[model samples]
Target: MAEFRQAGGKIDITATKAIAYHEVVVIGNIIAVASHSAKIGEKTSAYTEGVYEIKKGNEEITQGAKVYLTTDGAITATAEGNTYAGIAWRNATANDVVADVKINA
Candidate 1:
């Protein structure tokens, strides 16, 4: 299990394997680009999702891309107009980097 403090609150994860409420700290290469609609107030707004980081190979990624990360380590990019309901990246860019994702419990 891993624990961290965020937004003046303590977050804890006790899963033997990575779960939905567990924060994921990933360091990999960008694999692809995705996009979706981001809601502003009560309306849907156009926005680029984010990049998918793979273990290897070069991928074209953009800011505001929408991707579905499977539990088996598979990333599927989607361009449909949908609001992501899980953890979202605050800063979306094309640069290959590490990301710390905090899942809401």
Candidate 2:
């Protein structure tokens, strides 16, 4: 038998640490962004899909480049030892601090 669950775009998460709104969160290999600010141990919603502005590393990311999440929660073009985040929605130069990333597309 099969059952239906809620839509998969958003999920409820318990904050392991204080999380600011829009901050990137990594659960296992899944990467998401907090929907709102939440204190440690508080429950919050996170969007698993859609494009968001995420901080980037010092590397230039071309449009549609595969981006990964660093240990410190920034986006990078390097895939080694990092979690897959999303694709860059636009080109990001080395001096750019952030990039639009479309996740779970």
Candidate 3:
């Protein structure tokens, strides 16, 4: 028989950079939200599947729209050359700095 691990909703990650709690982090092609603060090279838990408030770029995002992470790390509706983060859980105007995103959904 195979040994079962913990649930998949959360997982341990080694910080590539100093990460603050609730911060959005990109690991390879996967995007996850930091559940707690951690310094670079330290291991910390992060949410792989959850809705979280993430910083957004200058674009209006509608609910259920696919959200992507720009090179600068902010979430946006654009997908060209950017990393797919998740779906927007709510609408966000261009002027809004934050959007509710379903991370890794």
- After superposition of all CA atoms, the RMSD between model 3 and the true structure is 1.6
Best by lDDT: 2
- Name the best candidate (by TM-score): 2
How far residue 91's Cα lies from its native spot in candidate 2, in Å, is 1.0
Cα lDDT listed for each candidate? 0.29, 0.91, 0.89
TM-score of candidate 1 versus the correct structure, residues matched by position: 0.28
Q: Which stretches of candidate 2 lie over 4 Å from their true place?
A: none
lDDT of 1 by residue, 1-105 (tens): 868654423222223333331223221221112122222232221112232233211233333444434433433233243222223244333343432222221
Q: Model 1 Cα displacement at 53 (Å)? A: 5.7
Tens digits of per-residue lDDT, candidate 3, 1-105, equal: 978898799878998889999887888888888889999999998888988888888789999999998888799888999999999999999999999999877
Clashing residue pairs in candidate 2 are none
Model 1, residue 69: C-alpha shift (Å): 0.9
Model 3 CA deviation exceeding 4 Å by range: 1-3
Kindly list the per-residue Cα lDDT of model 2 for residues 16-102, writing each as its tens digit.
999999889998788998999999999999999999989888889999988999999899999999999989999999999998899
- Summed over model 3, clashes come to 0
**Backbone clashes (count) for model 1:** 9
**Clash count per candidate:** 9, 0, 0
Q: Estimate the TM-score for candidate 3.
A: 0.89
Report the error of model 3 at residue 17, Å: 1.8
